[model samples]
Target: MDKIHLTFSQKIIVNVFRQVRIIKGNLVHQKYFFILKHEMQLSEFKYMIHDLGPYSYDLSGDVEYLLQNDILQKYDGQISVGNNILDKVDDIDLEEDEIEKKIAHISSFIQQLFDRTLVSEKNIELAGSILILLWDQEIYVKSEIWEKIKKWKPGFFSLIEFDSVWDILYHKKLISKEVYIPNNYIERLKCLNSGSKNAREYYRLIEKFFRYIFKNELNNFVLKEYWCDGNKKIDFSAENVAKKGIFKKMSKYSSSPINTIPILCKNQDRELFGSDLVESYELLNYEFSNIAFLTIRSFEHDQWILDEMTRFYRENDKKSIKKILFLLQDIDLIDMVEFRLRGIEPSGILKEKLRSVITNRNVVPCS
Candidate 1:
């Protein structure tokens, strides 16, 4: 069996099989396994894994999250399906037609799951949740598997010739239903009663809000205005998902609009804030276009930092690039782009000086 490097979606299936094999391979668990086996013997399964969830759920009361995501595969463990169905094969000495008949019987069971469960909209939502859970794993579902589930219904098979493919998946422990408790009235009530007034929290929330705006609202900006524009000066817009690495995987339901400027979302406090003017100058000087400085803290770039940034630009002779800082609360825009440059590694010192220039009250009365 080949080892499968599962995506988040595939992990659900792989983990189910891995867990079952672990249980089956355990000598101490044999008694419980037989109890499960005996029950499975009576079921009309075309393959074996359909019974594992109920067996484990009956014992543990908690469903495994991995099984629910379709992330598992045979390579996770050495497991097989059809032993129960095939046990009588030798006794019957099956002819070719007889073998085909048995195969069809098994295939039908597998077909039911694909047709009934996976392709349903409910399961797609489940898939989305799984992706969210696996967010840290950096697994993304592309359009191919997305469309596959969209077309599934109960009793539908991807291919008629394949016997027991779907059931085998279940029996071999590659996929299992993950039971989730839906939000109740209490959760709804709790959601309604929530509000945070902290200054830093407010800044973070505001920054988060723009992320949604840039993703959803800005997509059309690129398509209609930027793409068709005669200048073609806009190589790419701020809202492009591919360019905005983190936003690529955000939930489509999020209220972010794709903006014409690059947006970064940082969730941190205000007093511990870093210099934006400095960072922006470094980024822009490095020719990192379409950048947006977004943070959950107050946008207070210091005076030395701003001065250093402006001086650096003048020194480099690329003064055309503009600097504008927007305060999320009042939409206050400030341009503090003048000060002397002083630092070690030109970039690092440049950042420090730019912030100092922007935020410093004295300004050093530069001539």
Candidate 2:
């Protein structure tokens, strides 16, 4: 009789089965185990962003191989590596230094996942989904973390509580407090600095630049050729999620209803006058649409737009004054994003801009 040898991965698969009883042949535990392996720097498998969570084809292949080799055994709604196979691997006398350490950690972590009093599938789904976001979403803010989870899987939002999941992961030291830092500053700066002066290209570049820079600020703030408010079309509109950070501050100081703060974006043309922006203002008639951002490549119209913004604010009452217009130029946007990337809260930059628009004669360049 020849002794059987087990690959490193097969041994891990075996150990994961030994500690945790994955009910009903649920294959997701394989992916969960691999995540532990990846986090511990034990495996190099890549994961795809699946609806349920991160899925790995390579890990699937390993599981299939183990099953075919009879190393993995399944029976009666449970799966495990047979005792005979486990004994065979023991006879091989493989080094257990790292593998045992990882399996022990993994096995311990698995116990934290389920509530022993009752089994809930949603908790399992929440665990995997949260891991995927924490691993790849780069979301640091606590509120945004929950918002993103709800946005990704609204059905589970009822079951997934921030305090509950966060406490478990935080207490376990699996996660650390994080801060937001925007990326591709140089690339975006170049695009804003120099791009097709053509109106269409300018609009596209503006969208790309803003979206890339302030993505962490809020999700889905950019839209193209989007129509809303009585079917009146605008280049785009931004629904700023207030009640947090700078947006919250704006509401408190401005003494305005910041809920549903709609910032409108208008496609640009090299017009001599700021008349084109009037179309942007008109779109604010939509219920709760209060703010507007106009991206201009040519600073030639900066002063002109500034003057026009004042005229509109003055003619309108406080209700309309709260609905302000911001002039977003290349340099100003670069400055805003740069401040955020350099560990400055972007909300401060925005506050200054809105302050300048409200109090000072000059625009703060889109706060």
Candidate 3:
């Protein structure tokens, strides 16, 4: 007979099957292995067999290979040692202790293989850090977390597939869902009571007030929320008003300047904005060309709240400072008192600083 050549992954799968057989004393459902694979972390697996090699292999692929080769049989959605391996299993002569030792040796070898297959240490660190955050929050929604993670480590994460990390963490049981209620009735009531009678109308009033106060300093300003292609909405946006014939006159010199600014606001019921807001910015940056400035504003009294939130994020998350600082720069703070006193005048100095920040970071402005 030709010698059966088992890959490192295949060998690990075979050992898992043997252990399951000893424990269950019957055929195991394929879903059992699937769930096991999803919830088992590489580190835990290493500890399981006293070996560090499991991380080097793709355990999922091994399961499929076993099923395909009939080394492990699947019937009625269940799996068991196949006829090909039944005789070998029956022929085993080793004592229980000896069998366990052999299994541990195999596991260590597999870990070695896994270590060889790893990406850079930095990539692993970032991936692990993000996973830990997701785990802590019990967040499983891929797109939701991916948007935030990308903002923090855009260059590194852009190259990774979110699903892959999700699968590994899921299999290891490192991340699981908990019942989450974003807002309770009391919280909702508070938001409703404190909220403006009509958010849209209130925004319109603010816009009118700013335009009236800064009539001399500002040419034109429109404030409204915009919904982009993905049905994603920008909380607040402002655009510069151009004098009649200004664009026509400037057409000869240059294209119309991108003057649209997206503002991230912190107010009651604003908790939903985190990931969704980031997603909107990403989409707008990629799809629109007229975005020139990004504004993050809150009431002056809420500065303490922002500071506390910043501290919480910095303590709980890795590289959060760089990400937050980049998004909400020192200049982006529009003190409610200051805005109320002076109105929204176009600040040439601030605009120049914003331009430099955007240019140096290679951030494509959004519409």
Candidate 4:
């Protein structure tokens, strides 16, 4: 007879059942086996599954196959080890000790996969810190976790960042998914032992890991803004404007310029501007010589809109005297200021000038 070929899912289900039976030393409830199978599907094999709105798995089908093949026996709403499985267990290669060791090796590999999916270096640092804190404390209360993080590094993280790190750790099995302690306490303890080390050394090792992984373009890499749309009008709403200004350096180095309008308010009549607008104006003033403001309101109005024109002069100023002389005629300080103020009140000519200057200076070579 040909040897039975088990699919990946079938193998996982069989292993889950085998482990349960070995640990329990007797028959196991069908519900308990199903629960373990479902958990493995969601956590270890989630990426392999297809979505049908809700996640689906073939645990039941695999179980039926196992029963038909005499690998498992069903009786009185419970599952038990069958003669075939017992004989297989007695096989030297499939002994209980060997199966456990294989399971542990596979689990470690799955954990590495989970760690690779972390979104950013900032997240990795925070996750590592929280893991260490949990190791030292050994408490899993939600409130206690937050308190510990704050006490360790005040204002270093926001609530959203904390929640994100916690979620990642839970999914990776470094922390228990259950909200309270004593739930998966044994597993949590094991995580602490595995991850616990000298704090500074751990951080140093993580930095080296990232450096190795991103070594390809570490010297000449430029930040790219993939989310930016060239044709989309720049949102001057308070939040959008503030974000743009805060990340202005990132936008400046991008391969393309972000399209922008002067200012937009939720209520057109209110004419409100956020502090970010003022900060952007100050930073632009510090960077450009010809860009001067007569008043704070003028800065808020639209004086900084001519930054593209000023940036061109700043770049040319560093070149030869001949180049400076040739660019002098093109650098219109008075006209640029006038155009900026006019743009605030909505003029077609000023808008055209703004668009032309912005497009021409959209991307400048890094110095």
Candidate 4 lDDT over 1-367, as tens digits, reads 5556666555655665554442221112222232233333334322111111112234555667778888777776656556666444323133356545655555444334333555444555455555544543444445455776677668878988877767766776767643322222322322322122332332332223222222321222111111223422111211112132212332354343322212211112222245433433443333332221111111233333344344543464443210100010111222322233223221233335534444545456337
Best by lDDT: 2
Q: What's the distance in Å from true for residue 291, model 3?
A: 26
lDDT of 1 at 271: 37
Q: Each candidate's lDDT (Cα)?
A: 0.30, 0.57, 0.39, 0.38
Q: Tell me which of candidates 1 and 4 scores higher on lDDT.
A: 4
Q: Which residue segments of model 4 deviate by more than 4 Å?
A: 1-12, 22-61, 75-80, 88-100, 104-279, 287-367
Encode model 2's per-residue lDDT on 163-236: one tens digit a residue: 46655665555565332223233343454433334445555555655665555544465455554555544365
Give the lowest summed-lDDT range of ten residues in model 1: 333-342
**Per-residue lDDT over 127-170 for candidate 1, one digit per residue giving the tens place of the 0 to 100 score:** 32232222222222222222333353333323321113333333
TM-score of every candidate relative to the true structure: 0.22, 0.47, 0.26, 0.29
Best of the two (3, 4) by lDDT: 3
Report the C-alpha lDDT of model 3 over 181-200, residue by residue, as the tens digit: 11111122223322434445
Q: How do these models rank on TM-score, best leading?
A: 2, 4, 3, 1
Task: Please give the distance, in angstroms, between residue 306's alpha carbon in candidate 1 and its true position after superposition.
Answer: 5.5
Q: lDDT of candidate 2? A: 0.57
